[model samples]
Target chain A: MNSTDSLIDQLAQDGAAPRPASLPRFVAPLALAMAICAIGIALVLEAPFIGMAINGPGPMLVKWGFSIALLLLSGFALWFIGRPGKATGATMATLAVPFILLAALLGADLAIGQRAFPGETWQRCLAAMAVMSPIAFGGAILAARWLAPTNLHRAGLVAGMFGGAAAMTAYSPHCPEHGMAYVAVFYCLPILTMAALGWLLGPRLLRW
Target chain B: MGKQTDFSGDTLDQLMASARAGDSAAYRRFLSEAAQRIRAMLARKIGADSELEDVVQECLIAIHAKRHTLDPGRPVAPWMYAIANYKLIDHWRRRGRSPIEFDDAADMAVAADTLASTDIETLLEKLPRAQADAIRMTHIEGLSNREAGERIGVGVSAMKLRVHRGMAQLKKIAEKDRI
Candidate 1:
């Protein structure tokens, strides 16, 4: 037997039993990380505690729907890009849904010509995202480090987007801003920035 | 890792599923079968290139490292080939040529006046006769620079210079053709 044959023998001897790298493996950790961030923000930041009860379910549901959709879609995209031979184009295109929904919401708001602007707690919203995005992103990176992602930049972008979405979801309860325009700009800005950060970091962190 | 264990009845999917479940004997059999399939596939694509074995090893390693990604319910052939194809692409990229096209180019060069392209003949004609003769004798005729120089009654360094100039001129001509 040649070196390759022996190498195969060694691999079998080592018994690389499968602990499957499924999407759920990363999701649980990411969800936990976001939950921790949300609680921390609530205790320290001292923002408005209004949830579906105070704001009514309509706006709160919309906010939760957008962020949660993004969270799940981006999580799926992240998992897709990390695997070799998986086509990420479809998953990536699917990510645009939430963004388009947000845009449509903002457009409708504008057509009605309400005097909507950033709410009093806009700083708190940005602050909450600024804190949460990186923590969520870090959790994702740790989980993805072992998956052997072939395309580092796309993986990173999805990871960052996943972080941004999680942060958005966690912060939604405390945020008083209901303007679609405000949510679109401030919420998306940190997510995009996190994506850029991930893009830059992916090559370095995800290199296997 | 047992001696001569029989696995002829099991399909690759069955073997892989067994491997995933911590059956080392099944894993060994699966890898050996995978190695043969990948070797045959690569031979068809790249012919008898030196990197063939290396690429097979790479595919095997990738399969081992990413075994968890495979769904046990699915057929194993597509997943195996996908990894094999990626390794082949990586091998070709590392070598800086599509091996099939490169092999064809080698064959055409060896064919010389009888089978050479008119485009190549025309390109060679554009060079000075001495430089063109040096390039053809060394490159196409499979002669060393010294042997080619001896045939043309020139020194080895002089022959080398002629071949170098001829190649540079050919590259310039080819680039111009693109424009």
Candidate 2:
């Protein structure tokens, strides 16, 4: 049989066998990596008020909420797109709404207050992107073994974007800054940076 | 994917939706119809070139690989038109009007316009090492998926998956080069 027939037969027999890649087969490993990364961040950073921020209705809640949404959507994009889907642009567009809102919030925050250009915030966020991308990309590359993506680099880019967002989700709890702009600048840039990194590394890491 | 009006998009879209849900019969039916539709579309786009059939097969394989991406809510023609467009551009480029060349590993699927070994090597360079190795052993050297998996220290299905994805990537690379 040609590949499509083989693939369809694969779906039927998949219940009884390990089979090739499927949604959960791919998701389990990436989730495990994110969990591990979350634990590592909590232990290593030892942020003072993580528990309060997580529990309290502060900006941390918003940051975490937005980051979690990004994580889920990016995760879905990564897994759903694994087999046959061209909805990445739409999905990525949905993914961008929060960032846009945050950008607007950042602009409004600057307009309302004489905020000094958060000098170290830029560096911190850039560093976060640099650090988190490889972790997420590494996680993604590991999962890439089973998840077959047709648009390889785009898969890698989304995977990296997922990674960056996961890192942000984990990192958001630690920071004292609460503005959406702060979250967007410090957090989102890293996600995109890693996504860009994924774009470049996609041609290499996600080749097959 | 551009526009093609030869077939009813709704019928093909439903067939694809059923196929994605694991209906083999639906998928087979879809392919039969899609093949005729794609062949006609390519003939119109690229003219009566000798590589028409080869490009047709390539487009079919691409459609199968990307079948999951087809939105049942949308028209299949545009989805199909996109795949055909990429495959045709790669085909014409492989017909040697472009400077860059890909390995043409899908050649075994079609006997038209067979490529040389050196072309494959240069082409494989663009891929990651493991994927390059997997495609080389399986497609170029004709190793069975299971045998290639054993050689590469991966499972047979993964070997199949890699080779499948590798060729798709090669097509993407070739398309990008045309721009």
Candidate 3:
């Protein structure tokens, strides 16, 4: 046999299995969960004062619960996408639906309450969104590279991160009650942290 | 003998698995076996005018660096070809050629035209090691004079002179051969 054929034979015998099928089922859920939790964590950290106003026992608890759920979802999705076969488009769309719904709900609420959103509040939200945008996209792309067999997953992650982050910011300027602190705490930190975590864990978790 | 042939396939598979696990010896063996094919491909693509050995080595290093991206279950031929193609394109770009339009056939023809006859190879063998390397890198490897100089730890002007002198000597030998 030719040397090239021999090299190919060697590659085939090295236990590189075709990517698993359950990838999208895992990835979509994980991405959604991560987004939700990151936003929740930022809200709690920035709005500790809200706890006293509400006469709550602990305001941070709500934020922590959301954050944990987000993280769990992201992790689970990542694990799922790291499996063997190609993930279906329907599976990805299923994951994206909730994000669109949530964005719409929040956007509508903010639009109706625009009178409350001041210039300073809008600025902070815009800044936070800007920072989060690249991080979210970078994280998604890195995750896709790590987990999915095809480069398409990486592209999706990058697109989703930027798209979702941009959408959140675009809607944020309309909400008067949603201060700059809220945007900084909710949107920015989560994406940055997720990006960092994804970078650290990618090689280990997403190995073929 | 039939059993032995089946065992050879199993042995190859085991070697690949071991290489994936970072076994250096398996990787070396794989390279040794693949070198001829790589050389053949390079020779066909760039022709005997250039230093086929340098291209072969560069291709090996690239395959090593990008090996992680290769799907172990898939055929390695395409991946190898892709890397080799990329390296050749890079070679062209470094030499200020617009690599986009340059095809394998054109590259081979250019390489063939630039190569000295076999007699020159004998004369090259007689030069100082560094001088010979500079000549080969500039003429045979198709590296720019600056690149050849950098590679041989000499200045560009010095490298140019070396190549000039080498070519002159080669011409003298060719004349002697004619006589």
Candidate 4:
């Protein structure tokens, strides 16, 4: 056997650690982040969960639908880019869907002559999201780091998006606003901010 | 894929599946094949096999460390190639910013391995005056921190800190220049 053969033999003795696809791994961390955000909303922000039920869950469900969809899609993209060769154009395109749909809805709202107003509590929404982002970001970064992501920047961006989406989902009940414009500005801004932060920090933090 | 192993019967996917299940023989075969393929791939990109072994070793180690990240449902080749490609980039980045060159001439390798003074001089020139003097005395001149500190009229720990910071700054400069 050559030196390479001997090296292989030695490495083989260590055995391969086979795992299920990474998609399922994202669920636990995301769930924990959402739980933390929910608790924070209840205790710190003092937003009443019962109040949402009183308001009829329609608006809350719509927000959940938007945030959760982005969460899953970005999570999917994260899984793809977390691995070395798995990043493809398709994974990126998939991530854009939620944003595209949200934009379309926002456009339709505007086209129908609905007045767009930055809700009075919009800044509060942003502040709450900002606080929750690090929690979700920490969880996603841990997973991404453990998975040994190659494209550190993209992985970080997706992780940030994932965090933002998780924050939005958990904060939905606290937010009583139904305007698509609010969702567009309040929701997309945090996700993008988190993504930009992730991009900036990826090179430094994600370097294995 | 070359003459490393006869993978005619079982494909890489099957081999990887078996490897993930702790089949030692299959794992060995897979790595052997992987090494050959990675070598060929690197050779194509780098146009030389001078540093091939180091890079291949890094790839294999990475693959082993990150084995759990791979999905058994996916084709193993893509995952393996992705890892190999990443290692390749790492190889390039490292080669670009290699800190010190060691010429292996039997006479020269031993004489001044640490005290490569001219190189240290040029490298230290980039640092601040205090840091550069601290590093020059302690490293190039082979003085202890205490001795160097006294000569430079600083405390021992302060001297050590300067040397440490100077070396770090030098590394940053080297990396920046390489890029």
- Per-residue alpha-carbon lDDT of model 2 for A1-208, expressed as tens digits? 7554454344333221123445566777778778866786777676645547544656766777777887888777776555443555776677677677677777887778754345444665566556665776677766764554556677778888888887887666666655556666677777887888787777567543
CA-lDDT, candidates in order: 0.75, 0.65, 0.48, 0.74
lDDT of 4 by residue, B9-107 (tens): 447777886776678888888888888888888755543333567888889888887887776556677788889888888776765576543222432
The order of the candidates by DockQ, greatest first, is: 4, 1, 2, 3
Candidates 3 and 4 compared: the better one by DockQ is: 4
Mind giving the per-residue lDDT tens digits that candidate 3 earns over A121-154?
A: 5455455545555544444544554443322333
The 10-residue segment with the lowest total lDDT in model 2 chain A: A10-19
Error of 3 at A174 (Å): 13
Interface RMSD of 1: 2.2
lDDT of 3 by residue, B79-164 (tens): 56666665655554454443323232433343245433455467678765555676678667879878876664555645655565
What C-alpha lDDT does candidate 4 achieve relative to the native structure?
0.74
The most accurate candidate by DockQ is 4
Worst 10 residues of 4 chain B by lDDT: B102-111
Candidate 1 vs candidate 2: the TM-score winner is 1
**How many steric overlaps are in each model, in order?**
0, 5, 16, 0
DockQ of all models, two decimals each = 0.31, 0.07, 0.04, 0.43
Each candidate's TM vs. the true structure?
0.68, 0.56, 0.38, 0.71
DockQ of structure 1:
0.31
Candidate 2 docking: what grade? incorrect
Identify the superior model by DockQ, candidate 2 or candidate 3.
2
